[model samples]
Target: MDWEEHAARLADEVTDRVSRWREPVAAVPRHELVPRWWQQVAGEWVLRDGPCDLEAWLAAAYCDTSLVTSIGALHADHALGDEKPTGLPTSSATLPSLVVRFLRHARLTQGLDLLDLGTGAGGLAAYAAQRLGSRHVTSVDVDPYLTDAAAGRLARMGLYPQFFAMDATRAIPGTYDRIIATVALEPGRGLVPVLRALRPGGRLVTTLANTSLILTAWKAENGGAVGQVERDWAGFMKTRHSTDYTPGPDALLAHARQAEGDEVTAGRYPVLDVSAAWELRSMLEVTTPGVELHYEENGRRRTACLVHTDGSWARATAEWLAPPEVHQGGPRRLWNELERIRNRLNAEGQLPLYGSRLEITPDGVCHLSRGKWTASLGV
Candidate 1:
């Protein structure tokens, strides 16, 4: 297979958006990094083996889209052809564009020591190692299998960078000049180890869990960092402590779908898929953390559900764009909070989440403010 040609074409495509990363994008062989991946087919995760179908492999590898390499605890590399695991994606080679965006946000420079957290398929680490000599780059991931696989793949391509298998939420090995986390970090305690590993005056770029907001901050003399919520948005899998994430709220969602709620009323607005609406999702996360949102459509009817650990649950059903029938149960009215956010959006035309000033203390607490709006995340 003419992988160099494919790589060159991919470089041409991505460099149009991130011109500075042209060389690294062209040099690294993304297909080699993600030899096997999982593709969801008809609501099932079907394995895709790159070597088995070169045409499909090249098409997917060179595209500006993420490729899932692991689902739940099953890595595509080890799955049988007949196996179709049902679980969340545990690892992936993030699209080339987002990796560039992260590096650009970090303001990378030669000779700077960099830490690449959440080294899923090692695409980001490979690109960074190629741009800045491998000696200056270190990649870390919680899954030892991922680190081992990525390290071997990178070495085969004549690129070598330090790799470590450790949970990023816990203690990291050493301090660095820059840290770029491709994983979504829980705003609270998860930020502690990462901040501790950042040298004074160093920069950090990452996304908060359950939100699409990108945070870019520079470490301060006071041990905290100060910057702003970037206007750009990106979502990543939250950092995991084990081989797979704890069971999701499937049982709670099933309950929300059928139970008679404490309150039921006609909603003012039509049912909206909160997960697909990035701005609204981020705002809702800021207003009420730990809310798991699920949306479904059957023929012309649509349903949106929200469940929280606090036992608050909301379900809305509607046809097309018609106003929804809303039901709420538990101490807090979850749907009301969502409508309040929507009303603010309709009234103000935009949200204060993007471009908000951000401050991170040594303990990992985040203070975000924009105009009269202010919110704190983390313990």
Candidate 2:
């Protein structure tokens, strides 16, 4: 089938997922946004030039999945033929369904001013410009090249939204009635600048870095925002601090794997895969930010590892459904803490992580409370 046919089918798929955003999904050409993307092939991040490979491009573009447009600062446009870029994804055209969900949460009206933060591939901004007039939309990104390219692409489709290449985490270019951030923001620091840029009583839809929490809140009279974590889960690339992707703590992972921990004990439950539990993972991230997790399943043996920047580490191993041996090191017993949180969940049947009450202060500190559990993000 042709590109138009693929686009139409993709629109139908997205509409099936979300009927409210049918028109925008049908109208916007997602292929234009992801003319070239990165795909993991053979354990390597290889560049896929869509224009050169129309069939492959059509298949990936129309599918409901993210297309990585940039690796580190290496935009797919600059990548050589067959080049395999390394590092975590810096930017991508988010999946169509997720984009529609965010737009739905924004509660856009006919002529409300909208700020599209993190215009990677400009898909969301293009859709918004199509739904609402381009005059009412503005798109911004940290990368100047991405902004310039997205503006050009949007113009080709008659979308002329104002495009700015600036840090969305810092002072924005203008105030808006609504702001949708595709870029994941650091937990506490996300709210302040977004609230500052939002007009009084305006709404903001965004996600926190290192967690899958789609947060929606409205600007309040006190320069803060009040919101609740949506029941839905979503993830996006974290806001970058440098031109290249910042390397994670690989050095620590090595040590955490081999070093004899300060404390060792038998886990109350079988080795658990924390990543498989959304509520548990999100809650742990809120309470202990920047903790990295790894889990492996080998035959009947299940092993889990947790590493934190504070020199804390935990390892658990056991057979399926059997009590596991846990080793914890450093100042905090990471595994023990996880077990405590897990025990609470097993008893209460849920963690106070999703749909929890969130109160953000003017300085961007967020206090989350649900039932008897409370945690501060900016601490």
Candidate 3:
């Protein structure tokens, strides 16, 4: 198959919307970067080998969608045909449109040094290296295997960018004119290094973990950064320090699934999947961090579950649009907190998350303020 044709088509699709990234989008051979990926089938991860199915491979590679390359500790390239590892996605070839969106947010200019954090499949690195010289781009990931693999793939295309195997959240090796993190950065010490790595007046574009708010800030003379939460939103995996993420709140979720809580009451609102509702999810995360959300639907019956690491859990169940039956337990009322956010949204026309003014201290604490409302995240 002529993969260039698919690449051109993808360029047309992405560049038609984001015209400035047309050159890199058209030039980078995305198929070469992601040769194998994982696709969900019947709720299980099934490996898709590109070489075996050229047509399907080209379609997925050139499509404007994320292709998971690693789940848990398993990378698609090394997975056996029958192996189906189940866990959160650790790496992926992020969708091309979103990649372009992030680069656009950086406001790239010729000769500017750029750092592409979370170099999973090297798609972003490839595009950046194509636009800016390879020498001007630096890509880093916690997985050395990822950096090595991305380097090999990029070398094949005659695009060689600096690739490092390091946890950027802990320490960034070098400073750059622009730093764009595709991975989500939690507020706290992790963010401190990122802010310190930025040269004064340099631009930083990234998302905070658990929320879809895209934060674009510039380093200031005060050692802190100043910017606004863009009116845009994007979700990304949180930065991990190891091969696989530590165990999630599965035990709490299992409890939330069935156990009768200390407080059982009729919910004022109908059951809604907080995870799928971006605005509500962001608001809840800002107001109360570290809440894990899950939603289930069976025919007309719907259920939403919220689990926190502090042993707090909320379960709400209902049929279709009917008001939900809520159960809450532990130190905090998770469901009630969600309801309060929903109530505020109903009372006010909108939530003050997006388009809010952001003030980041040198210590990496973020303060978001809009009108009379204010919220802070990080240490």
Candidate 4:
């Protein structure tokens, strides 16, 4: 199979949907960027080296799906078979369609300076360079190797966007007319640096970490940014201070699965995976941040578990549509909180998350308001 032909066809399909990004989508070689990736097989992540199987490589590259470029610090470059990495994905080539959608939200035009935040595989930056000139684009990531590797590949294609290995959550090197973050920013992580680095009147596009909220703001004259949550939802891997994700809630989850809790009650509804329910998940994350979730379905027995770094845990199990049996431990009764939020949803017929108004202060305080409810992140 001809990979170029496959890529061209993929570009055509993508352009049909995102008509504005057609040229860049057609020009960039996604297959080259993701020559090796991790694919889960029977609960273990295994390497899929594209060079070894050209047909499979074309198929995977052309498909509209994210490819795991790195698991923890163990990037596909150094990873081999059967050796399962313990942590979650640290980096990935986000699905091309979503990448185009992000670019669309950025409202790009020729000659505007742009920063492609989180240059994992440099796919977004490459597309930006292809649309705008290479000199107009700059890309940054915390991982040095990702920047180095992406730079070489991008240069080989005659695209030379400035690449930096720096923590984007902190100060960046230069200001930009537009900033688009492909990585998610954690709650309470203020947008001050991002706002400072964005030119006044320039637009910023990014998502909050662990939630499906897409934040789009323009730098205000008073050193802050004002924006709203976009109606469409998008999720990205959280930004990291280091190469791997922080140690997760493995211990909390382990204890929650088996240990008896302080209180046990029946759930108002069947066991539900909060992660799958974006609006409820976002509201819950806002109310109780830093929660990790795990869910499984075994025939009629569906189970949902929540664990937090603050020693809070909850387990809910149910059969089919029956109410769930809930167990709560630690300081918070998570299932009850969820039911409260769900009750709000039932009463209002919609969540306040989508289309909510956002007011970000100069010092990084993010105040979110929709109707009568309000929530704030940062001080």
Candidate 5:
């Protein structure tokens, strides 16, 4: 298989718009950074190493899509036949189109310094060097292996930047004309570092850590930056500190195990995965706190539970032929609350986070103002 031909074909696919930075993308061998990738197998994700097939690897790497290099911050580490799911990406190089879209936003000049966070596969950094020169760009990543891998990939293409292995949450070594974070920023995640990294009036484009929120704010004259959500939507893998996500043994498990009483109400809303709900899920995590949801489905039984910190709980379980019997306990009946919220959305035709206006305070509280209710978030 001719790998170079595969790479050239991909270059042609993304040619017209990327022409300015064509040499960088075309020449920098993508197969090097993602030498070994992951695939889900038998309810688990597994690794498939490369330098293997030219046609297949090219198709996978340059297909204009997101390749899940890591999930739940466990980067393709766990061995097969031993664990339940493992290897969430601590980091990754985002898709090519997303990278170029952001670069187009940057509007690079001949000599402007950029702080590229989450260096990932180093592909974007290489493109930056091509556009603005290698001396002007600085890339940072939390994982040393990732930074090193990116460094090597960039070196092979004869492009190099001040690539450093450091946490972006800490002090940025120097001020930048533009700072673009590929990783999303969470509320509890500090903002001082990013603000301090930017020179006054510096423009920053990044997504809110876990939500479908994209922001393009400029550094303010006073201290912080101010901006609003971008009309479009983009989501990245959540940042992580632990080796793997241990969301605890499902806080809702016990509630589901022993459900009973008239507190049980038969409800009728198509069950949704709480994790997929983003903003509302985060809001519930904050307002109610310490809550968790669990899912289990067999040929016969299907169950899900919503459990909270203050011991408030709700659960639903059903055999294949029957509707779920809902149960509740503790102070507030959580399931009842969920049903109510869903009903409200049905009446209103939308949920709060969808197209909701956001005002981020100087202290980093995200106040989502929409319609009648305004939610003030804790920074």
Candidate 6:
């Protein structure tokens, strides 16, 4: 079939995934949303625009997957195909599958007041407003241009909502019965404003950054929200107030490519695909901020560093390195904890990470439960 046929099929699928009221919104052409996006080619991020060929553009737009918008998290708008290894992906219209899953989790109802945080491309907002009524929906993002562009797309579709360009960390204007965040929340106190904006008996759905933790909370009678980790998956881009997320493979990849190490050793243990381990990854990111893992040499050697703004450093180098020497200077033994967690997973064949329970008290100190090992949320 042609792009139009595929778009119709995709629209039907998305409508069924969201709600009946969203059919028209989903039917709006996908090519319209992603008229132009950035893709990494030969390790360089370049702007790729369509609407030239209907078929090619439709294939990219209607498919239930994410298109890379910015590489290295920097604006790919002016990238001259000079930046290497791309950059950490800054933004994109998240895959349709993930969007569907989140909308289902959100459970939008007709005439319900909704708030879409991080209105990337405004697809989800379009989907939400189609069912919930455009007047009842509000979308906010920190990027003014992003919001403006999404607003323009919505206008083309004849779907209108109050699109505001503002930081989510501050007090939003109105109360919302449902708030869905597509951007990950900052470590602590950043989500308090989100919670504050929710009206009583409201629904809050969002995903933690860089991890698989998908959280859903509902406003209770007494002004607090309580909910557990959803038994599914979702991920959001890390929230950014600056130009881009700082310090990642961009800085260290070059260092590793020409490092003066003794030898490239074979790894002792099987490498774990960290994406499959959501809770453990979330806990690790919070407990050891700025920790990035690097695997090299036929996937044998692993060097992970935990860097802090205080200049304290902890480095762990494991290979078929025999003893797996762990260097340390910070107050905390970051590598030791990782090894412990690794051992825990090994001992039980799996950690009690997933399928655990979450309880959010009124003050937002999330208490996580896993058998007998209870832990605080904010680390």
Q: Estimate each model's TM-score.
A: 0.98, 0.92, 0.98, 0.96, 0.79, 0.83
**What 10-residue stretch in candidate 2 is worst by lDDT?**
238-247
Better of 3 and 4 by lDDT: 3
Among all candidates shown, the one with the greatest lDDT: 1
For model 2, residues 75-145, the per-residue Cα lDDT tens digits are: 99889987777777888999998898899899999879999988888999988998898999999888998
* Lowest summed lDDT window (length 10), candidate 5: 76-85
lDDT of 1 at 89: 92
- Candidate 4 per-residue lDDT over residues 1-379, each given as its tens digit: 3566777787887767547688788788888889999999887888999999988988998898899989889999877765678678999998998998889889999999999999998899999999899999999999999999999999988999999999888778899999999998764544667888999899999998778999888889998888998999998888888898778878889999987799998889778888999889888888887788999889889989998888989999899789988999999988888898999999989988889998878887777999998998665
Residue-wise lDDT of candidate 1 within 76-175, one digit each (tens)? Answer: 9999999989878989999998998899999999899999999999999999999898999999999999999999999998989999999889889999
| True lDDT of residue 237, candidate 4 | 89
Point out the worst 10-residue segment of candidate 6 by lDDT: 260-269
Cα error, candidate 4, residue 367 (Å)? 1.6
lDDT of each: 0.93, 0.84, 0.92, 0.87, 0.67, 0.67
- Cα lDDT tens digits, model 6, 1-379, are 2455776677666556545644654456667778777765654556765655666777788887787655554444444445443446666787776776787788777768999998877878887766667898899987776788888988887889889988787667789989998888753466778878899989988766656677788887766677777777666787777436666544443443345333333333444434445655666764565455544333576555444444344444655444555455535555455666777767888765456677665555566677897765544
Error of 2 at 209 (Å): 1.7
- Give candidate 5's error at residue 92 in angstroms: 3.1
Show the colliding residue pairs in model 3: none
The total of clashing pairs for model 6 equals: 6
Looking at model 4, report the run of 10 residues with the lowest lDDT sum. Answer: 185-194
- Model 2 has a clash total of 0
Quick one: ranking by lDDT, best first?
1, 3, 4, 2, 6, 5
Position 61, candidate 5: lDDT: 76
Q: Could you give candidate 5's per-residue lDDT for residues 201-293 as a string of tens digits?
A: 787777665455666777787666666556556777544443334464444466456767338777776555565766555546435545666
Poorly placed runs, candidate 1 (over 4 Å):
16-18
Q: Which 10-residue window of candidate 1 scores lowest in summed lDDT?
A: 11-20
TM-score of 6: 0.83
